[model samples]
Target: MPLNFAHRGSLTEAPENTLPAFQKAIEHGAKAIELDVQLTKDNHLVVSHDHKFTRFNKNVTGLIKDYTWDEVRQIDVGSAFSEEFAGTNLPTLEDVLDICPHHLFLNIEIKNIPVIYDGIEQRLLDTLSHYNRTENVIVSSFDHVALKNVQNINPDIDLGMLFYYRMLNPWDYAANSGLAIRSLHPNQVYVNQTFVQESKRHGYEVYPFTVNDVNRYAELVDFGVDGVFSNEPGVFGS
Candidate 1:
């Protein structure tokens, strides 16, 4: 059976990237949780889908990079999702790590494409190292350079490359591109039997993202994906 990763911690149930969302994923019996990470002005790693909080909250608007950890912590990231989630503040990367179960895999996607976080790779690795949970995590990014940095610093860590558009023979590209990534996370719309076959042949796993429809998820599973990132992990297995 393919692993079911809750995208942004069951985004359909709770605020994306918030502690409550992650907790909800756990409740739904997700085998893995996929979340985005970005650096604050104080260099603290925070859990959020976008570089700015405006998407999550209208009242709290600003680039996460422009705020320090203290300022970022004060933003109500959950109220916009629902009033029940009011006063739900942003979660620090450490806070999320502290709650994740040992058996669950964590895909930490570095949000570096829009904003360059100079030393984020080192800090992320260091934090994971501190918790002694690097083995349970996969560091992924759209930023190939950031992924390379992760590999250079800690070759043992699993690295995944995330891309939205369709790429011809992506498995081959990842295997031979000298980046040495272990997995490919493509948009679910582009995934098909040929892609899965190529990925399996190349010894790279394929995990597509944001697949919420039950029929589509089943189609991808039938195509032989190693796993899928879904907003509704419960539909797959919970």
Candidate 2:
């Protein structure tokens, strides 16, 4: 069966990317979880989707890269999602790793697009090395250059390429890039049986993103995607 990953840990069930959401995803029976990460100004790895905080907090307007960990924690990220989750705070990558189930897989996406964080790959790798969990994680990014840096730094760490649009036979590109992409995370709109088969035939796993519809979920399975990044794991994974 395809691995069913909770996208940002069931964003519809709890605050996206928060610890509670990840926990809820576990409760929902997800064997894998995909989360976003970016370095804070102090170089601490923080879990958040956007560089800007305005989406989660109306009063706060700043980039996550511009704030320290202490400053980033001051905002209530969960209240925007629900009243019951009012005090929920953003989690660090270490925080999530500490709480994640040992049996589960983690897809830690590097949010290096638009705002490149120099030395982020090394810092991330160092942190993973400290925990000795590099084998259980897949580091992915939209920025292929940053991905290359990650590959150069640690050839053992698995890497995935995240892209939304067509790039002239993506599987071929990944196969020929010398980066040795273990997986390809493409937008759900462009996935089909041919794409999935071609990808696997070339030794790349196809994990399409943000699939929520039950019917579409069935289609993806029939199309033979290795896995899907889903907002509701219980709905699709079940």
Candidate 3:
């Protein structure tokens, strides 16, 4: 079956990236949970979609990389969205990993292209090594170097390439990189059945981004792609 991933959890119904949102997505029957990651001040991996935490309490300041996890935990992330999510603190990658269900796959995007996570790849590998989900996780990023770094650390895990927009030949990029792309994500206009077929021909899967409007989703489904990243994974098929 073609997979459906919730972009930043079921962001349509809950605060993006919070535990509540993730849990909501899982309950909604999403097969995969997609989220973004940034480095904390103390080198811990933080599960946040943005480079900074502007949506949180105004007391929180500075780049996310500049603050320790302890400091980050104090900030409230859900309040900006509404009182319902007022106490939502940013979750660490480990925090998220612990809560994720065994049946669903994970899609983690390394934010900030070219920013090295230092030992983050090994950290991720070490964490997954203990879990029964070695084959179920997929790491993705627009940062070719970052994805390549993760691949260098653990080749057993699958990796995908993410593109907010498309190029004439994304397959060439993946092919030249010496990694098998389990998935390729491109902008709507950049995608066509030809690229989808061509990517599949090269042994890669295609899953585009932010596709709303039922007709467009239907068309994308017709094009032979494997999945989609949508703001409302729960409502898509309903």
Candidate 4:
């Protein structure tokens, strides 16, 4: 069976990317969790999926980079999801590091596109080093340049490239990209049996994103994908 990564930390059970969601993922038996990281105005590393607060907080308007950590934390990120979770605050990357068990695999996607954070790769590496979480973690990004920066800073740190669109011979692309990539993460729609096999044949692990349907999950497993990102973590017993 392929590993199932809790997308945004068991997002169905709690507000996405909040501390409650992450804890719920652990309780739901998720061994792997994928979350997004963005830099705050004060340079604090925060856990959030959207650059703007529109999805989570209608009262708050602006990009995450527009506010300091203190201001970001003050906004209620959970009320939009549920009244029970009202007042739930956004969590910092360090906050997640403090809560999540060391044994769990972390796929931290850097939300750096459209609004790039200067030197975010190095800052992320520094934060991981401080938490002693230098291993068992894959830092992914849609911005290949940011990923290259990560590789330049620490070649030992594993890098995963995130792609939304289907590409021709992605494994060959990765091989020629000059970065020692650890894995490939594509939108689940683009994944196929040949894609999985070809990627693995080229010595790369394949993990597709945001797969919530059970039948689709089974199909991906049958296709020989290494893992999948899902909102329902416990559904596949991962």
Candidate 5:
């Protein structure tokens, strides 16, 4: 059966990338979880989807990189979603690592584009190492340069290439990129049976993003995808 990766930890239920959302995902039978990570001004590794807090915080409208971890944590990232999660704060990478079971798989997507964070790859590796959570974790990014930086720092860490556009031969692109990619995270609309088959043939897993529809999930399973990133975690578990 294909794995069900809770996108931003069952984001449909709680504020994305928060501790509560991750807990909800586990309760909803998600064996894997996908999250976005960014660097704060104080060099803290924060778990957030957007570079700016405007989406989550009404009082604050600035980039995450401009604020320290202290400032970032104070913002109520959950209230926008609902009152029940009013006090929910942005979680650090370490914070998320604390709650995750060793058996749970993690797909950590580095958000480094538009505002690059220097030495983020090394810091991420260090944190994972400190917590002994390197295993069963695949670090992915849309920034190929950041992925390459990760590879140069640690060859053992698995990397996933994330792209939205359709590629004629992604497997070839992966092979040519010179990075040992573990998976291909493409937009669900760009995925097909041939894409899945070819990716598997090249020894790379295919995990399409944000698939919430039940029929689409079944179709992807039929296409032989390794898994899917979904907000509705319960819908994909078979």
Candidate 6:
């Protein structure tokens, strides 16, 4: 069977990336937990999908880059969802990693690899070294150069390149890089049997993004794409 990733840690029943979400994934027997990473002003790598904190606080509209880790921690990441989730916190990658046992692997997405997070590749390496999990990690990105940089830092760890839309030929880029494009994160609308066949034919795995509909989830699985990234992983599992 293709790997079943607990997208953002069983996010259907929990606030995405919260400890609750990750715990739910582990309990549900997911093999790996994938997450997004952003850097705080204090050089902390937080596991949030988007860099803006505004979703948590309407009045909070500044770039996360503008705040220190301490400042960012004071806000309520969960209350934005519901009062029940009010105390749910934004977690540092290290915070979550320490609690993860030997059974799990971390798929870390480098969300936007611009100058702000320039030294981030090295930082992630250092953090992974602390846990001795460099071998257990997979670094991925939409930015090919950043993926290349990550590969440069640690060639052995698996790397995946994310795609948003279909192009004339997507695998061409991944092949040119000399990087094994294990997965492609294309939009769900663009995924069909033809795309899946082409991806596999090219030796690439297809796992499209942000798909939550149960019927559509099954449709993709039937199409033979490897897996999916969803805000509601539990729904598909059903």
For 1-238, candidate 1 gives per-residue lDDT tens digits of 7877888887777888888889988988888999988999999999987988788777766699999999988888878889999888889889998899889999999999789999999999999999898997899999999999999999999999998998777777797768777898999887889988988898888999878899988899899998898887655344
lDDT, candidate 4, 149-222, per-residue tens: 99999999999999999888989999999999999999999898999999999999999988888889889999
Clashes of each: 0, 0, 0, 0, 0, 0
Q: What digit string (tens of lDDT, one per residue) describes model 2 on residues 1-238?
A: 8887888887887899999999989888888999999999899999988888778888887789989999888779889998989978899999999989678889999999889999999999998898888887899999998889999999999998998887678988998888979999999988989999999899899899888888888899898888888897655356
After TM-score superposition, the amount by which residue 65's alpha carbon in candidate 1 deviates from its true location, in angstroms, is 0.5
- By summed lDDT, which 10 consecutive residues of candidate 2 come out lowest? 229-238
| Per-residue error (Å), model 3, residue 146 | 1.2
After TM-score superposition, what is the CA distance of residue 177 in candidate 5 from its true location, in Å?
A: 0.6
Which lDDT value does model 5 have at 135?
83
Q: Which regions in candidate 3 have their CA more than 4 angstroms from the true location?
A: 234-238
Model 3 superposed RMSD (Cα)? 1.7
Please provide, for model 5 over 11-85, each residue's C-alpha lDDT reduced to its tens digit, 9 standing for 90 to 100: 888999999999999887788999999999999999998998888886898799989999988899989999999
Question: TM-scores, in order shown?
Answer: 0.97, 0.97, 0.93, 0.97, 0.97, 0.90
lDDT of 3 by residue, 21-116 (tens): 888888888888888888887877788877777756666677788889998888888988889888888888888878888877788887865455
- State residue 10's C-alpha deviation in candidate 6, in Å: 2.7
Error of 4 at 147 (Å): 0.7
Whole-model alpha-carbon lDDT for candidate 2: 0.88
lDDT of each: 0.87, 0.88, 0.80, 0.91, 0.91, 0.77
**What would the per-residue lDDT of candidate 6 be over residues 1-238, giving only the tens digit for each residue?**
6455667787766788878888888877777778888888888988888777777767777777788888877878888778888878888888889778866767789887453477778788788888888876678888877787777887776788888767877767777778765677788888889888878888988878767787888899899977776666454343
Model 4 residue runs over 4 Å out of place are none
lDDT at 232 for candidate 1? 76
